[model samples]
Target: MQERTFQLLGLLGFILSGMFFTAAGIKSGDLLTLGGSLVWILACLIWLIPVLRDKDQER
Candidate 1:
Protein backbone atom coordinates (compact mmCIF):
# COMPACT_ATOMS: atom_id res chain seq x y z
CA MET A 1 0.00 0.00 0.00
CA GLN A 2 2.77 2.41 0.80
CA GLU A 3 4.53 1.60 -2.41
CA ARG A 4 1.30 2.06 -4.30
CA THR A 5 0.88 5.44 -2.73
CA PHE A 6 4.41 6.41 -3.62
CA GLN A 7 3.89 5.36 -7.19
CA LEU A 8 0.63 7.26 -7.45
CA LEU A 9 2.16 10.35 -5.94
CA GLY A 10 5.16 10.11 -8.21
CA LEU A 11 2.95 9.84 -11.27
CA LEU A 12 0.95 12.80 -10.10
CA GLY A 13 4.13 14.77 -9.53
CA PHE A 14 5.35 13.95 -13.01
CA ILE A 15 2.12 15.18 -14.54
CA LEU A 16 1.97 18.28 -12.43
CA SER A 17 5.61 19.09 -13.11
CA GLY A 18 4.96 18.92 -16.81
CA MET A 19 2.07 21.30 -16.47
CA PHE A 20 4.03 23.61 -14.21
CA PHE A 21 7.03 23.74 -16.55
CA THR A 22 4.80 24.48 -19.50
CA ALA A 23 3.15 27.37 -17.71
CA ALA A 24 6.43 28.65 -16.28
CA GLY A 25 8.08 28.53 -19.65
CA ILE A 26 5.24 30.44 -21.24
CA LYS A 27 5.01 32.99 -18.47
CA SER A 28 8.67 33.66 -17.72
CA GLY A 29 10.56 32.43 -20.75
CA ASP A 30 13.29 31.45 -18.32
CA LEU A 31 15.53 28.58 -19.26
CA LEU A 32 16.13 27.74 -15.61
CA THR A 33 12.44 27.37 -14.92
CA LEU A 34 12.03 25.08 -17.89
CA GLY A 35 15.13 23.17 -16.94
CA GLY A 36 13.95 22.67 -13.39
CA SER A 37 10.63 21.44 -14.62
CA LEU A 38 12.27 18.99 -16.97
CA VAL A 39 14.44 17.69 -14.17
CA TRP A 40 11.44 17.21 -11.88
CA ILE A 41 9.45 15.50 -14.60
CA LEU A 42 12.31 13.12 -15.28
CA ALA A 43 12.76 12.38 -11.60
CA CYS A 44 9.07 11.58 -11.26
CA LEU A 45 9.21 9.21 -14.20
CA ILE A 46 12.33 7.46 -12.96
CA TRP A 47 11.17 6.98 -9.40
CA LEU A 48 7.56 6.08 -10.19
CA ILE A 49 8.37 3.29 -12.59
CA PRO A 50 10.59 1.28 -10.28
CA VAL A 51 8.35 1.75 -7.28
CA LEU A 52 5.27 0.75 -9.25
CA ARG A 53 6.98 -2.28 -10.71
CA ASP A 54 8.15 -3.38 -7.28
CA LYS A 55 4.64 -3.05 -5.92
CA ASP A 56 3.25 -5.17 -8.73
CA GLN A 57 5.83 -7.84 -8.15
CA GLU A 58 5.01 -7.96 -4.46
CA ARG A 59 1.43 -8.68 -5.34
Candidate 2:
Protein backbone atom coordinates (compact mmCIF):
# COMPACT_ATOMS: atom_id res chain seq x y z
CA MET A 1 0.00 0.00 0.00
CA GLN A 2 2.79 2.37 0.87
CA GLU A 3 4.51 1.59 -2.39
CA ARG A 4 1.28 2.23 -4.23
CA THR A 5 0.92 5.57 -2.51
CA PHE A 6 4.42 6.56 -3.49
CA GLN A 7 3.82 5.49 -7.03
CA LEU A 8 0.62 7.52 -7.14
CA LEU A 9 2.41 10.57 -5.91
CA GLY A 10 5.15 10.10 -8.45
CA LEU A 11 2.59 9.73 -11.21
CA LEU A 12 0.86 12.88 -10.14
CA GLY A 13 4.13 14.77 -10.05
CA PHE A 14 5.07 13.56 -13.48
CA ILE A 15 1.72 14.62 -14.92
CA LEU A 16 1.87 18.04 -13.35
CA SER A 17 5.47 18.57 -14.30
CA GLY A 18 4.87 17.52 -17.86
CA MET A 19 1.88 19.77 -18.25
CA PHE A 20 3.70 22.73 -16.77
CA PHE A 21 6.80 22.23 -18.85
CA THR A 22 4.90 21.69 -22.06
CA ALA A 23 2.80 24.78 -21.51
CA ALA A 24 5.86 26.83 -20.65
CA GLY A 25 7.62 25.61 -23.75
CA ILE A 26 4.74 26.57 -25.96
CA LYS A 27 4.39 29.97 -24.38
CA SER A 28 8.09 30.79 -24.39
CA GLY A 29 9.24 28.86 -27.45
CA ASP A 30 11.96 27.22 -25.34
CA LEU A 31 13.44 23.85 -26.26
CA LEU A 32 14.59 23.22 -22.70
CA THR A 33 11.00 23.21 -21.47
CA LEU A 34 10.07 20.69 -24.15
CA GLY A 35 13.00 18.52 -23.16
CA GLY A 36 12.01 18.73 -19.52
CA SER A 37 8.47 17.62 -20.40
CA LEU A 38 9.79 14.69 -22.40
CA VAL A 39 12.03 13.66 -19.54
CA TRP A 40 9.12 13.77 -17.13
CA ILE A 41 7.06 11.59 -19.48
CA LEU A 42 9.90 9.07 -19.63
CA ALA A 43 10.19 9.10 -15.87
CA CYS A 44 6.45 8.49 -15.56
CA LEU A 45 6.68 5.50 -17.87
CA ILE A 46 9.62 4.10 -15.92
CA TRP A 47 7.81 4.49 -12.63
CA LEU A 48 4.63 2.97 -14.05
CA ILE A 49 6.33 -0.26 -15.16
CA PRO A 50 7.14 -1.48 -11.66
CA VAL A 51 3.63 -0.81 -10.40
CA LEU A 52 2.14 -2.66 -13.36
CA ARG A 53 4.51 -5.57 -12.93
CA ASP A 54 3.64 -5.84 -9.28
CA LYS A 55 -0.05 -5.96 -10.08
CA ASP A 56 0.47 -8.64 -12.67
CA GLN A 57 2.50 -10.72 -10.23
CA GLU A 58 -0.18 -10.52 -7.55
CA ARG A 59 -2.48 -12.76 -9.55
Candidate 3:
Protein backbone atom coordinates (compact mmCIF):
# COMPACT_ATOMS: atom_id res chain seq x y z
CA MET A 1 0.00 0.00 0.00
CA GLN A 2 2.78 2.38 0.82
CA GLU A 3 4.47 1.58 -2.45
CA ARG A 4 1.22 2.23 -4.25
CA THR A 5 0.98 5.59 -2.53
CA PHE A 6 4.47 6.49 -3.67
CA GLN A 7 3.62 5.55 -7.23
CA LEU A 8 0.54 7.70 -7.19
CA LEU A 9 2.47 10.60 -5.74
CA GLY A 10 5.15 10.21 -8.36
CA LEU A 11 2.57 10.30 -11.14
CA LEU A 12 0.99 13.37 -9.63
CA GLY A 13 4.33 15.06 -9.29
CA PHE A 14 5.23 14.23 -12.87
CA ILE A 15 2.04 15.79 -14.17
CA LEU A 16 2.26 18.89 -12.01
CA SER A 17 5.89 19.44 -12.84
CA GLY A 18 5.17 19.17 -16.54
CA MET A 19 2.49 21.78 -16.29
CA PHE A 20 4.70 24.03 -14.22
CA PHE A 21 7.53 23.70 -16.69
CA THR A 22 5.31 24.57 -19.59
CA ALA A 23 3.92 27.61 -17.89
CA ALA A 24 7.25 28.83 -16.60
CA GLY A 25 9.01 28.22 -19.87
CA ILE A 26 6.40 30.11 -21.82
CA LYS A 27 6.39 33.02 -19.41
CA SER A 28 10.06 33.30 -18.57
CA GLY A 29 12.00 31.32 -21.15
CA ASP A 30 14.29 30.13 -18.39
CA LEU A 31 16.73 27.30 -18.95
CA LEU A 32 16.92 26.53 -15.25
CA THR A 33 13.19 25.86 -15.01
CA LEU A 34 13.33 23.67 -18.09
CA GLY A 35 16.24 21.70 -16.70
CA GLY A 36 14.52 21.40 -13.35
CA SER A 37 11.45 20.02 -15.05
CA LEU A 38 13.53 17.41 -16.81
CA VAL A 39 15.03 16.40 -13.50
CA TRP A 40 11.58 16.14 -11.92
CA ILE A 41 10.41 13.97 -14.79
CA LEU A 42 13.40 11.66 -14.41
CA ALA A 43 12.88 11.43 -10.68
CA CYS A 44 9.23 10.53 -11.15
CA LEU A 45 10.15 7.84 -13.65
CA ILE A 46 12.70 6.43 -11.24
CA TRP A 47 10.16 6.41 -8.44
CA LEU A 48 7.63 4.61 -10.63
CA ILE A 49 9.97 1.90 -11.89
CA PRO A 50 9.74 -0.43 -8.92
CA VAL A 51 5.97 -0.43 -9.00
CA LEU A 52 5.96 -1.06 -12.73
CA ARG A 53 8.49 -3.86 -12.40
CA ASP A 54 6.48 -5.51 -9.67
CA LYS A 55 3.35 -5.36 -11.77
CA ASP A 56 5.17 -6.88 -14.72
CA GLN A 57 6.51 -9.66 -12.54
CA GLU A 58 2.99 -10.51 -11.42
CA ARG A 59 2.03 -11.42 -14.95
Instruction: Give me the runs in candidate 1 sitting further than 4 Å from their true place.
Output: 1-3
Q: Sort all candidates by TM-score, best to worst.
A: 2, 1, 3
TM-score of each: 0.68, 0.72, 0.61
Cα lDDT tens digits, model 1, 1-59, are 67578669769967796878868886998887877777777877787787778877988
The residue-level lDDT of candidate 1 at 33 comes to: 80
Off by over 4 Å in 2: none
In model 2, where is the ten-residue run with the lowest total lDDT? 1-10
Q: Report every candidate's CA lDDT.
A: 0.78, 0.84, 0.77
Tens digits of per-residue lDDT for model 2, 1-59:
68877877878788887888888898999998888897888888888888888978989
Clashing pairs in 1: none
lDDT of 3 by residue, 1-59 (tens): 67767777769877687778967876898888877777877777787787778878979
Q: Count the clashes in each prediction.
A: 0, 0, 0
- Candidate 1: residue 5 lDDT (0-100): 86
Model 2 has a clash total of 0
Task: State in Å the error of residue 24, model 1.
Answer: 1.4
